[model samples]
Target: MKGILSGFLVVVHLMVISQTSPTDFLFPAPPNQKELTSQKLWSTQYYIHQFQSGGKIPIVYADGKPSGLFADTCDFCMASLEGTAFVKDSSGNSTIINFAKSGDSSFVNCRACKRFAASKLNVESWGRTLWSKSQGFGDGVKNYRLVPFRTIAVDKEVIPYGTVLYIPAARGKKILLPDGEEAVHDGYFFAGDTGGAIKKNHIDIFTGIYEGNPFPEVIKSNENKTVDAFIITDQTIVDALAGLHLKKAF
Candidate 1:
């Protein structure tokens, strides 16, 4: 009887080993050769917000007042949209294969327009007003209230619109002012906005006018300062690896 019990135990051990072994049941069958020959396909769209400064430009508005330094040639207040593509592999690795910029032609001018166009310094002066408008100037107007110091563009499917986020400084780097001082800026910015330059997980911070002046100094000073941007995401990567998508939308 002892011999029979020992034999039964041997059979149970063999069964367990077979169940766990890669050669037995642990490995799935390789994909079919013909299916493997087929290319994998994935599709995704990338978008950015088109943000225009709230001030008026020199052009005439329908209301006919001087659009100010930045005013109503459709210069400062517009939104943009562009598209991009991504590919997925059998191993579930996704990569962005192509990105293209598409949208209103007006959006391009906001970023690339010259500071002094043909001798009019509209572009230069407007940058100062942009800073001032963001820092809480121009009450009594409906659209002139200060927005937020920071604007983050996110995937609505991942992080919903109108959500407020608390952005901390970037790792190991503090925000430096023109006075050469390091300051901690902890602020809450709502997700009510978007921009052509702002991609998923990317943020564009609005710094106020340095000394009530725009143009060369304010523009030059912007080159070196870094601001903390807070963005919301659900830890899912549908296109490329998470963080900000900076590729130009086609």
Candidate 2:
């Protein structure tokens, strides 16, 4: 019986490492090789929250009274979408601000009062709902909150949300995590966010903005570059990475 149990454990370990889809049974049947390998094809790009200090647009109250300036147009664009921006204060210190869309007016939360004119920033900021306050910036689809360096947006039809992926090209990259810790990429990424542009054969990596823009630069160097990717079948590893990503920290 002990020998039989040891054999069972070995089979389980092999199953976990072999990239079995979650839908598979405990003793999964063999997969179609072509279908399985097809998921390996990936085109990688990255997205970032805006962090411009030299912004040209002014964030103002609904009445058109000036409140603060955005870092730049790209900063304004991403801030509206991502729900967060790093703004330059009077003393030239960068500060974090949050935005939420409400009808014709958008609410800018940080240094100013709640109601802000959408007309000032233009029409692009009109449709998004308020960002989750508890999420620090914004939440992803469902319960998957966005994590700066750890989250990747995928076509849900291809790679389901909560799936764990391994990218060989990103394996040894080093990054400064949000909590100010320097960490090495384990090559594991969580599929937590989605975008309209994220269709088949593509994955959008979320490399959150930082003051110095250091970590983003590291990820940017690899942007638009294709790399071999694998879905991790190991439930233990998937759960660990997914849980960390949902916690909204690296």
The RMSD (Cα, Å) of candidate 2 is 15.1
* Span of 10 residues, lowest total lDDT, candidate 2: 17-26
- Assess candidate 1 and give its lDDT: 0.27
What is the lDDT for 222 in model 2? 36
Q: Model 2 over residues 2-27: C-alpha lDDT tens digits?
A: 23333333332332212212222122
Runs off by more than 4 Å, candidate 2: 1-74, 81-83, 86-134, 210-225, 247-250
lDDT of 1 by residue, 68-147 (tens): 32333323322111211111223433222111222222222443444334433233332222211111111111222212
Predicted structure with the largest TM-score when compared to the true one: 2
lDDT of each: 0.27, 0.50
